[model samples]
Target chain A: MYQTNQLADATINKSESAVDVQPDLNQYLMAVASHQDKAAFAKLFAFFAPKIKAFGLKQFRQEALAMDLVQETMSLVWRKAQLYSPEKGKASTWVFTIMRNYSFDMLRKIQHNKEDNLSDDLWPLYEEAEPEPDYEDDHLMREQLIQGLEALPPKQKEVVEAIYLKEMTHQELAEHLGVPLGTIKSRLRLGLEKLKEKMELHND
Target chain B: MIKHHPESTMIHAFVAGELPASLSIAVSAHLELCPHCKAIADKATKAMADEFSGNEALVELAEPTPAQPVDEFATMLAAITEQPTDAPALKSAAVESSNQMALGEKTYTLPRALRQFSQTKWSGLGNIQRARLGLDEGDVHASLLQIDADSAIPHHTHKGYELTLLLDGCFEDESGRYEKGDFIILNGEHHHSPYTAEGCLCYTVSNAPLHFTSGVSKLLNPIGRFLY
Candidate 1:
């Protein structure tokens, strides 16, 4: 069992209200992970491909590169789905991480003109699955994280993603989101604080 | 205990895959030895996932535009699914690499991130030995630096960002003592002479050469180009 702070509860309730309006992505991912179900994978593709393209367009601003990102990212998701653990985290995170890392390596290749692939060695996809004695405790942390994600308001969540997932600067995010720079900064700070608190709770 | 770690912002950049290869390698090595920072990274990863999920609903809301080319994606999906799963260089590659480095009688197992780099043969200059890790990160240079027992480096400052991650043994400078797994970053501002009592092996990455601040050590500045 984990302790749920007030903010966490509030956010969970808000997302719960919105839950019926959205598909359960985790279920779709689990189907792909356990059964190699192509239908579930297709659903995932339909959901994430456009988002990845949008991210690529935002970053690369080139249609060819954006299309390449979509293809490569979805391909990776298909190959590595079996390695993902729902007890450890959400499917969206696992897929997003793969996309983010692949884009990072692709950008480096284009910028540095290097052929070597360094992302795998730097951030191994199977690192979390390495056998550890405290494997059971990770489930509790996962529970806490599921609740913590709900706790964060949608606006703050968007701000956090823009900064961490998109690697956007405050000014870039302000312009991209069409909000004031000060609001972006404040949301980021608040979101990071909440994230830190959640981590501390897990550590305890 | 590890006394020094990468700054939070750097760790966040690392998690976001924003850092260059050289810096990413150094931070990855440090995270292997420090669990405290790993937790923070994991938390940030979870947050990114949550934020990523938020987009699913938003993308759906903007539907009826018929802009998402479903036919092209279906083609891609069919091409991907038809291929056998045991395709790319995915799993089992991590098991083959030997992660050990030797300097005279001492042998140290390097962090996994550093193991991917094939190190050059160790060459010595006075009491210090350096082995370069050939990573392509523009102006950045990555090396495995080993100082013999009771050896001291000359007082120096960095021209650009310098990252030194202690892999084994212990060392101290003007600032404080560093044990195994300490991640120390120095720039143009700080100047320090580091000495080790027990000999230490460090993974260092820097974009520029060290500038020797002292009199006789200034001659070694020319050698810094080769070392950095």
Candidate 2:
């Protein structure tokens, strides 16, 4: 009973009023990183925990494991908050990267019991070599991304959601959606191109 | 210059954590050297985050079951917040030394992603040398393969899938010539003999043994199982 239409409508509304609420996220992260502010941490948890749980459920498809992912991801966020650099990317993108990496690590561990060899030190952490374009406009990027998602045609949005949120392979997505593989690929390519264009326009 | 790069779909797969661990490592190494792919990957990740947030209300809440489970969340929170006793050592080690491995008189710097496995020793086979990278235990095999200049690998097809990331120099095969930072992925359907003119180093990951397709090199087919 996931309401795709309602979710899209809510996101579209959120995008319209995003400017007032966006800066606070980056500020809260900075507060937690600089002072270990419990109040800020709680605020971050309240905002991200449920979203991460949704992400985990989408990935693991098990409530228990998804909860574990939320716990692990938030805990890492608390410990590594100092590593957050405003110069690199947006607060949401940084948190998303951590959650994604943690989810991948957990999935890998479950599939194979080689935990001893697959230590955290061995995994390549996200390290960008070049300075990201429009780093200072991270909030703008986040707002534009939501607006862009709202702008996609229904079919394109579905394709993008299956690939990004559900982590579905093209073959799997094609089978699930009852579409030809070529159609799925084209939808996804078109969706991403539109998103890129929207973000670029916002940067200017 | 990198003449070839990983396709956008592959990068999306990598970002989504759908790729196998070995292939993920190879792509990570390639990303370190290829900025174009890196930029695309960054955008893909941001888009994914935004998409997830868009569907925020749909995520179900975890309900506590009455089984007397330890408060895992509390335990995790405490574990992460606690300062590690080895913090100093970890801090010093964080500044990774430039890792360079030498083959004969030629030396090449390893990509940051591959530097962690530099301690493993390289084993030689004819003009080719390889070092198996131990990544916990899994069916997928990953290694560094270095072929001397003008050397040719026996013509072969993969049993499963093979992903190669050129770390240095150049090589030519049926597809095209691959330069540094090139990502080459092959499957059971492909058959090619790769030869390098200026020598080449690659990070390769394979799920199954390569089946030799041609001449006297076919005699080494049985050994190909262990070669990768």
Which candidate leads in DockQ?
1
Evaluate candidate 2 and give its CAPRI docking class based on DockQ: incorrect
Candidate 2 lDDT over residue span B1-228, tens digit each: 676788899889988878877777777777777766777887898798677555332212233467857555544444555633222234335545566777678888887667667677888989898999876446689988989999999899998988899999999999988988889888999999999999999999888888998889899888897667
Give each model a TM-score.
0.74, 0.69
Per-residue lDDT of B68-151 in model 1, one digit per residue for the tens?
655666667788877555433445554566888666898788887888654567788899888887666668898999899999
The true-versus-predicted C-alpha distance at residue B71 of model 2, in Å, is 11
Model 1 chain B: worst 10 consecutive residues (lDDT sum): B56-65
* Tens-digit lDDT string for candidate 1 (A166-190): 4555764664466899999899889
In terms of TM-score, the best-performing candidate is: 1
Q: Model 1: iRMSD?
A: 5.2
Alpha-carbon local distance difference test for all models = 0.75, 0.72
* Deviation in Å, model 1, residue A34 alpha carbon: 2.4
- For every candidate, what share of the true interface contacts is present? 0.37, 0.19
TM-score, cand. 2: 0.69
